[model samples]
Target: MSSVASQVILHPNVSKSLKVLGTNLGRDKLYRAVQYFARFLAWYLVSRGYKVQGARWNALKSHLALARKLMRLGKPIEHLQAALRAAQIAAEPGEQITTICRQLGYFGYLTYDTLVWANAIKFFNFKPSTAEKVSKNANRLWLAGILFSITHGLLKAGRLANDVRKLQNAHLTEKGQDVDRDAKLGNLYNARDATRHQFIIDLLDVWIPASNLGFTNLNDGVLGIFGLITSLMAFRQQWLAVNGK
Candidate 1:
């Protein structure tokens, strides 16, 4: 498809951001960062005693698009937003009490995933189906890069470097949490070809929820997620040191 056809009408608020980032960063990666930043901001606002508004609205729109595409909900954004807002009001008097509200955990997760994926698609200029697999592929490369560079990067993660593939299929339950009680995402290591350099860049992203029981703040959630990443990196380093991969 032509670039124009694939190009999206990102929010007015985001146009300037793209302009600012133009030509200075890699393709798709820069936008992917923006999408993540957007999610972090939404969580940040909620933590700072503010309600999620525009971000939430656009978030719903993005997720709604996905749902419609996949034949899930098949509805417009306004209908869902109105319903969500009313439900939010009916759920709690304020942020102080939301537990009483009747809401599904999957809804919250879906919203977060949808918004992230939407921004990612818009920013990366890729379809959702394609972007969905990018991380997994990139992570595989990331793990390989670590092994190649160190030859023994697995011991640090408390596993052999060759076993890195396990993480790709592992779940929170399969791999018990560290002392922190925070679980890790599906896979942290990925091997991706950087859109800019064309040289491969190995990287990882470990997603953590804001709440343990569904009431934690975003910052803590991110920290917890990254904390796991830190361990993985550290372990990789240690394995390399010991094994000299």
Candidate 2:
């Protein structure tokens, strides 16, 4: 009923984190402002009925098993692409072109699972399937490929010259900028561009920025993981956006 209860209800991970944080997620009273925002979000989502009590309990158990498997046995995520594909098929917008009102009344795509799965599927389409855990090497290569794709796109555009003259790409110099580079989707190359990619989510948790230049740390490995994801995503995006194939 309370706002705090709402957040915990909706975001089971936060609910768990609150438990872990020493009855308040181990955060300090000094972070009053941050706590308020956190409380507000929890309450808001709760009020909006975002939490799934049944799913939360089941998911937490599955997630714990997976974590233990990863840590102790070192088992990798298997059939990841297939799982992604299936999940995508389940959650994605139907091929049918139904009315917006019909879509709204269904509340089908509005849930968190649908939202995350949709992007995860998209990422899977663009990124290679992996047998092992996500690694820096893969991270770098994925980042590289992302940059390459974006840059290749840019080189197709025409207006990229005068502005990009300063940002000579490591790969572009060898290949030269194309017409794509000449276009004006400059914000796509921004530092905050990291926000664009699919996140590494586990169970009820979605990775969020923990390292605070501005935002509160939420979720497990919230700050460090998302920061890495964002940084790599941004770097790759910029590299691709600026460079040409």
Candidate 3:
């Protein structure tokens, strides 16, 4: 298969984004470019007094900070811990309890899944049944991670929708009918709509096993490498069985 096809087969979301950008840049370079652009955009908006309403703004800031800290490659466990801290700080809003819980839950499941895969890969003399069991557990962990993400997206969107409703009701009560819309609240509603739409896309993406375990937005080079190794191991086992080795 072509390189592009291999990438699409292995990492559809990342490849799609790169295709959208119409760049021939390597995955790592493109990913870094996107992250830097996002960080710059967030800073520019905040500097211009544009902010997401309520604790959402803080959440955005925290994410930006987290991104800056992880701009360079580091230990996976350290990155996961930083992600957990960012999520906790972001969840300080009164209504984001569910969102935060889902974030933490995904990380937990992902860590478990990664560990299981590591064990299976490292254990050279794994019995066939043990390997099968590990594979089964990894699949379950992947599903759990996806479920947590879907739940988080749902709760976050719901909270924003509720805010929009309250804003609409208050406006109606004061003016006897809707007139000029509150821009801030309207933005929140729009954001909620976007989140719902993205969640649907995410659900589809997670059905693919190599989709970063649904814990991040960028290309996961590590997961891709691990997945490739796992595939080769499985293939090797199958070949051995066929050859009666």
Candidate 4:
């Protein structure tokens, strides 16, 4: 089909019309359409960062790790640009991921000053308002990023698992001995992916809420632990991806 035809078919009104015509349109299709329409709103709030009270980091969390590594290694500005491109390509095409890449790209541009100042403040441990200001900002940003990863990643994995379950159920037949093997294989893959996502989600959900409730502030110590473990996992993933393992 032509691009225009595909767009017309995917349009919300068209989808609704199909549903009205007794088409067995899945709820997932409707949900995806709604998400597409809400992309701009989500992107706007996400770009507002901490300003809007509850905006989380989204995929910018991944970029932040690369940012941290780049800044620490004194990598050139070009390296950051390359990393931003990489991140953009890795993420699915959508306003939310676009905002995340842009936000992290802007931060990457500040490497010369922001990274230097941040490092100096950390090393010196200035106990006055300057230190407090730095600490507070860092803590809040880290908390936002960590929570964002946990929540969104879990939701995505859960949705995948649910879809697989639906497919598996739809394949159930009267002939019990001749089961649909493809559905079984798909469920196996879903189970593996779900387990991985749940593991990370569980790991963060435990300490993150606990740290927040106990102190009402997720500072360096709390977020640091979350970031550290997640980063290690990310590194492992990168290694596997690069090696085609």
Candidate 5:
């Protein structure tokens, strides 16, 4: 029994999962998954006339959201640092501009979101109107950040496509460079795949802030599913990164 127990504990998959859960990003993703699930479940229950159950799920979602906000208290500075780093790195003008803008947008969103969290916890005694305004601004900034991310992804995809075309054209004439050409193509393909994955995540996530800012009439159920999908996608990426897979 001890041998079996040790084997289970030492399993690679189990170890990797434990490593994933050990990180803040991993834990936050897991919580976000559950939170959005609760949101969708609450909406579904209420639509089916299960008022009491729906309320319970709604409470769960709210609590989890507050917890996530607390977890992200220091993230604004991280975005600011990223923006600073991007400014120093040499890249195409468009890439640098979009990256800096995206980071700044996220910095703004997280800064205002901190205020929202403080108000919720009574740490700050803002008026109802002020709180609402803060929340709206946070969502707007989040939406802007997501839009910038999408634009970055599109720009990257276009550049990758052009590189791919050039590589293919070079392959025809560069007979002795087959190995080098293939290696470069492989790297580019991997980058393209990663960019596409992030693009999809950004696309799904945009609707969440858009709905919050009243740009769309999407309901909680729809928004919940979108959040859930993007959370899982991000979670998977984080998991792979942690495991070096």
Candidate 6:
């Protein structure tokens, strides 16, 4: 019994889960998943005439949003630094431009979002209209960031496709050459897969800010599901990175 208990305690999966939960990103993703789930549940319950129960879930969602805001207090600077780094790195001009714009958009969003969080916590006593304006601007910036990300992903996919075609042609024509075609193709495929994964996540997430900005009329139920899906996708990626998988 003691040996069995020890085995369970020392399990690799358990260790990896703990490692994932240790990071701020991991914790945020977990909380975001729950928050979005609560948002969907609240909407469903209210639609079914369970106002009181729905209110409880709505409160849960609000609290989780507040917690996430607090966790991201210093994230604006991180985005700024990322933008700077992206500018220095060499890449196709389109990719480099989109990457920098995306980072800057996020930086703007987070800066405004910080103000929104402060207002929510009563740390800043801005007028209600001012608060609304700030929040709207934040959502706008977030949407821009996601749009830039999507553009970057599309450009990356196109480049990858071109590379694959070129590699295939080279392999066919240069059969006597010592080029490692298979290894190169494998690397390109992996990169393409990662790009596609992020593209999907971005596509799902864009609707959230769009809805907030009134560009879309998605209700809480649909928005909640979208948010939950993107959060889980990000969480899985973070989990794999943490576990060295």
Best candidate according to TM-score: 5
The per-prediction tally of clashing pairs is: 14, 21, 0, 0, 0, 0
Which is the better candidate, 3 or 5, if ranked by TM-score?
A: 5
lDDT of 4 at 135: 43
Off by over 4 Å in 3: 1-79, 90-101, 108-125, 172-181, 206-245
Residue 2 Cα positional deviation in candidate 1, in Å, after optimal superposition: 32
Question: What are the per-residue Cα lDDT tens digits for candidate 1 across 45-91?
Answer: 66666675635833743554344333322223433454467455643
Backbone clashes counted, model 3: 0
| Model 6 CA lDDT for position 60 | 100
Worst 10 residues of 4 by lDDT: 23-32
Clashing pairs in 6: none
Candidate 4's C-alpha lDDT? 0.47
Angstrom error at residue 204, model 3? 2.0
TM-score per candidate = 0.24, 0.18, 0.42, 0.40, 0.95, 0.94
Off by over 4 Å in 4: 1-127, 172-202, 205-231
Root-mean-square deviation (CA) per prediction:
20.9, 19.5, 20.7, 20.6, 1.5, 1.8
| Candidate 3 to truth, TM | 0.42
Question: What are the per-residue Cα lDDT tens digits for candidate 5 across 10-78?
Answer: 998998999999999999999999999999999999999999999999999999999999999999999
Best of the two (2, 3) by TM-score: 3
Per-residue alpha-carbon lDDT of candidate 2 for residues 27-110, written as tens digits (9 for 90 to 100): 222132232333334444455676564345335434432332223221122223333443444321321111222222222212
Worst window of 10 by summed lDDT in candidate 2: 202-211
Candidates, ranked, TM-score = 5, 6, 3, 4, 1, 2
- Residues 1-245 of candidate 6 have per-residue lDDT tens digits of 99999999999888998999999999999999999999999999999999999999999999999999999999999999999999998999999999999999999999999999999999999998999999999999999999999999999999999998898887355664535788888999999999999999999999999999888899999999999999999999999899887
lDDT of 3 by residue, 1-245 (tens): 69978877779555444453452223333343344344445544555677654235445434543443333323345535755675657563533544444445455545544545445446345677876665555555556555666776877777777777777777355663454556767689768866775576456536445443344444333333333343344333343333335
Q: Report model 1's TM-score to 2 decimal places.
A: 0.24
